[model samples]
Target: MDIDRRLKQLEDSIDENVIDVYDSNYLNIPIKLAYYEIDKYSELVRELNRIRYACKTYEEKELLIKDYIKIYLSSRKMYLRILRNLNNGAVKILYPDNLDEDILYRALKNFKKFDRGKPLNENLNTFMKVKLKQNIQDSNQELFKLKHYPAEYINTFKTYIGSKVLRYRNDLVIYKDAFISETEPHIYSVYFNEKTAEDTKNALLNILAYLNGHPSFYFTENYNFNRKLSELYDQFDLLDMLRLRKKFFFESKEYKEPIFLELPVLKQRCVLKIQITK
Candidate 1:
């Protein structure tokens, strides 16, 4: 109920050895969130409580709570999405070994986006974060007022922050998967059947300070064609938006076909049987 108590509970729940299920079929599903660190998550809980007791409702409370929700909401939803969308009834998470947080940047050094004709010169190029395409809802406002959706739209693939396997649930998952499509149809998904890297886990918890909203999580920019920013953050379905993560980082080479990266899932058994009427 309180910060320390909750942190204790979370500490209790984490077992780097904890596994979700034995079925190998589900292992391939994860994209990547981050290596999860209970201590880091604990810090967030503490920060939020500090704010709660320190701030009045009219003060930063609303904004802080909003930021607090942003941190945990996606985490709470991840495995649930597997149970909901995928053909599953339960999901389990694990503390990663290296969850290999350092892999992405290293991999990206030689990273060539899946669909792009040119390989990225990491020093000279950045994996642009594409904002989800959107339109003016103001009863078809002036053409100038409409959002400047990228011409590449869905195919504008982005980089993988391995921790994403943890921080984001269905939304980031969808986006990553869609990015996979941008590669080649031969590219398939895979996971570690274990845990992630330490940096990867910590990275997930590190963003807690960005209660104001982290630009790294931006799916689409709010600028119009003229580059003016819009106040509204519109929504887009993954079906409309699109795509997850892994290995191949230890070696220095271009991406090999048929796979994106490997996210690790534990092999221990943890299940919550909730009856649902589908």
Candidate 2:
């Protein structure tokens, strides 16, 4: 694994094209390597600057910088490992003769756990899980807590409420660290403390399911689709939150109890709990 070899590959990469890779032909094999760079340095530097500017002492920077270096080195090693696999013919590219076969082959090769493979309760690789978990931990949270959105998103109506709100694939997002409290019984919280977005979404779906299942709990949406939510939340959030399936709790016809001074609906108990399992 010489630097010269990678440089040479870079030169040869110009010839690689999707038209050639996807065409019907004889046994033509295309070996492509796209490096996925894992970057933590910028975030680390930001932490360092924050600590240097504000922290009473700069002793924290040493430990944090050291950890960042370790992570950077580990990322380099993984890239090398992936390269080694490609060099050793362990990782396969597309065959113009049979394009889909290699995809199945690669999936079978990378298969680790038997998962349902849905986004809700979706699985992440070890490194990806670690990366995501690091982000959550770095947000100055303990192992777990019922999270709340930042004070900026202070709308009583439809809104996303998560410390780390990820609008990953679509409009609807995972919410946390937020509760509108009128009474203990009338508290609907957007809460999260999960390792993966899938699990968080699964928890959300479960909450939705529970609410939908209860005969006493009637789920109603605002008839007006024209009026959008605040500009604070994304256009997707404003749109998705109003989507009947994603409307967990919002300003509906629930006139009896209100979230704001005179808001219509009562923010019901979202009651998302986080527990650590061995």
Candidate 3:
């Protein structure tokens, strides 16, 4: 699919003069903070594209794509944080000047009805007004402290966050496709060893079962013990191996609370060498 070519095309489209546009808008402090975050994210995207283009092997490219996915997820979280803060700041600014709680709550009700698609109910409106008043009071106390920053400094920091958000979204799709193209053929063949394939398959099925609200089986790992019932022992050993593998997957922040079918066989606790997933 010429993924490198697409990446280069996307990289080239990033506007260098986005900050100047933000400066014209005369946005408040929260939006300005968002702009600065966008600048940092853009720089990261540029560097990631550079490294991605340099990859020579399929494995290297796949690893790079995985790293890009991590970066994309993190960037999305950062963007959402900025947006939330900006929304909170907006609510503070739009809050009623009058100190009367009843008056402010009424005003907020009207504001929410017009601004949000689903207006906050009466109970939530009451809570929001209380919180908004507190935030506004806090902002007033801190406003003077922000005056020390020069106009030039703020302008320099007015970077565009939207462009980077779009770029990362595009990059994720492209890189994900590239990763699949590179790895799909060899995923079961080259990646899965005969000794581990059965256990790995069972572990994945167990995880799927849990997701589907079904009970899964667990196996115990017996390292040194040998028994006449070879098949039964082998099944138990596979379960333990699956348990160990599940532990490693759980260590990744991407997979939360990965469920395993079998528990580890505890005899003498020994450390298992955990390999980083590519």
TM-score of each: 0.19, 0.20, 0.24
Instruction: Evaluate all candidate structures by whole-model CA lDDT and list the values in order.
Output: 0.29, 0.32, 0.34
On residues 144-229, what C-alpha lDDT tens digit does candidate 3 reach at each position? 32243211111111111110111111121111111101122211111221222345545533443332222223222442222233
After the best TM-score superposition of candidate 2, give how far the Cα of residue 193 lies from its true spot, in angstroms: 36
**CA shift of 126, model 2, Å:** 27
Question: Highest lDDT: which candidate?
Answer: 3
Alpha-carbon deviation at 132 in model 3, angstroms: 21
Backbone clashes in model 3, listed as residue pairs: 217-261, 218-261, 218-262, 219-239, 219-262
Clashes of 2: 9
Candidate 2, poorest ten consecutive residues by summed lDDT: 257-266
Number of the candidate with higher lDDT, 1 or 3: 3
TM-score of candidate 3 on Cα atoms, chains taken together = 0.24
TM-score-wise, the better of 1 and 2 is: 2
Deviation in Å, model 3, residue 13 alpha carbon: 25
Candidates 1 and 3 compared by TM-score, better number: 3
Q: Model 1, range 55-83, lDDT digits (tens) per residue?
A: 53333443444444443543333323332
**Worst lDDT 10-window in candidate 3:** 156-165
